[model samples]
Target: MKNYPQAARILVAIDCIIFGFDGKEIKLLLIKRNFEPEKGKWSLMGGFVNEDEDLSDGAARILYNLTGLKNIYVEQLETFGKARRDPGERTVSVVFSALIKIDAHDSEAVRSHNASWIALDARPKLIFDHEEMVARAIEHLKYNAALHPIGFELLPERFTIPQLQKLYEAIYNIPIDRRNFSRKLLSTGLLIDTGDKNNNGATKKATLYKLDTEKYKANFHSFWNFMPDSMKE
Candidate 1:
């Protein structure tokens, strides 16, 4: 192998900002660093990219290692390459943002990795520039949610209209009118009647619905003007 002798050495790291929805509020998956400069501090799930490994592959590997999940929605969020970002080394990090259903991940893997699903609003301080990475990921999530079928990725296979409304309220951190919200979602025709009710079997249980995934894929980029009046800037 040939190398540039005059070039400086640099390390590459992949960090995952994994978000989940637990039928209430948004949550972040964080791990307690078991080694290094800040061993006990909360941190995003991350790992160093291996020799000959692709960046996306490294991100996927890191996420799966922590959550025992695969084939989930993952997108490259940003690159953080500020000098001395990692006190232990001169490293550049590529970040990936993932949204997973809270009930679908492996509980054992999370416990083994010392990872916990912390509510976004109540998360603790994180190591390095991971806090900034999380803020940026939230921005991207908000942006994408306005133009994409975000619930399809984070919510369960079947959920009530109120559940969907609660998700939007959590993401935007604002109150939304329930009547208008339900009306708007039904107008989109993106939701399909599942002919089922909430599992608890409440007498007045809300009907459950699922995304019309086929229609979504047919016009994947067509979800527009989806934000409620309060959600818009």
Candidate 2:
């Protein structure tokens, strides 16, 4: 085997920014570090990559260790390789963004790792470069939510248009016009009226709707202008 004569030996790490929407607010899953180099501080669920594992597999393993769920919606957000990013070692971190249904995750798995879900806007100070990774994840969420149907990943199996609207509002931190919002979403033809109603809201019960599973899976990547102009860059 041939090796590069002057190749730098740097460690590789994978950190996940897990986002969830609980009907009304967007939240993040964070862990209270249990080891040195910032033990007890809020941090992302992360670990060093194993020598024989692939990048995505390593990310999935880290997420599973913290959430006890598999086959989740995960993507590589960015790679942070700042020389001094890790105070304890010279490591290049690959950040992943995962969207999950908050209620479906295993609470015991999170508890085992000293992890908790924090409202996105109310999160505490994070360790190392975790905060920056979270900010980038938020930007990615907002950007993709505007152009794709990815927001539905954070919602329940069945929900009303108002509930979906609130999810988007929470993601962008802005209120959407009710009338246009409903019309636009309906026009997508991705929602199937479930003949049910949401009896949980303070106001009158709203009709329940579920995704058109066939259409959703087929058109998940198509462009959809769901964000309000004010929220756009």
Candidate 3:
């Protein structure tokens, strides 16, 4: 076996910033660092990419290992390649942001890894460049959720308009006008009346609706300012 004489050793890694909505606030799935260099501290779920695995496959493997959910909204956000980013090695990392429904993931898997869903705003200082990665992912979410309906990935299949509004408000950190949000959302023709209602122990029962799959696919990338003017206030 022959190797390049002057080539330096470098390791590839994947870091996934998992986001979820528990119907009230948006949160991030982070793990307690289990190995030293920074053991026992909070960190993003990450792992070294296997020699034979592609980058995307490595990311999916890491996500599945932590959440036990697949085919969700996963997007590659950026790459961090600072020479000494990893105190232990010369590693370059690819960052991914995943949006998952909080109730759908495997809690046992989450616990096995010492992971917790901490509120996005309340997450503690992360180990390394991960804090920057999450901040970038947050901006990415705001930018895309305003133009697309990807936020639905953080919601249940059947939800009320108010539930949807809460998801957006969590994402944008803004209070949306009830009538305005409902009017804008309904006019898009993306939701289908399921003829079911959820009161959730409330005095008023709200109608449950699901996405019109066809319309959702058609408009997934189309621009619609779901971010209303109320956000400016």
> Where is model 2 more than 4 Å wrong at Cα?
1-6
After TM-score superposition, the amount by which residue 231's alpha carbon in candidate 2 deviates from its true location, in angstroms, is 3.5
Candidate 1 structure, TM-score to reference = 0.95
Best-to-worst order by TM-score is 3, 1, 2
Q: How many clashes (backbone atoms < 3 Å, residues ≥3 apart in a chain or on different chains) does model 2 have? A: 0
Please write out the lDDT profile of model 2 over residues 42-128, one tens digit for every residue: 999999999999999999999888888899899998999989998998999999999999988999999999999999889999988
**All candidates: CA RMSD (Å):** 1.7, 1.8, 1.6
Query: What tens digits encode model 3's per-residue C-alpha lDDT throughout 99-171?
Result: 9988899999999999999998899999979999999999999989888888788889989888898889989
Better of 1 and 2 by lDDT: 2
Off by over 4 Å in 1: 201-204
Clashes of 3: 0
Candidate 1, residues 162-212, lDDT tens digits: the string is: 888888888988898989888888888889998988866332389999989
| lDDT for residue 1 in candidate 3, whole number 0-100 | 13
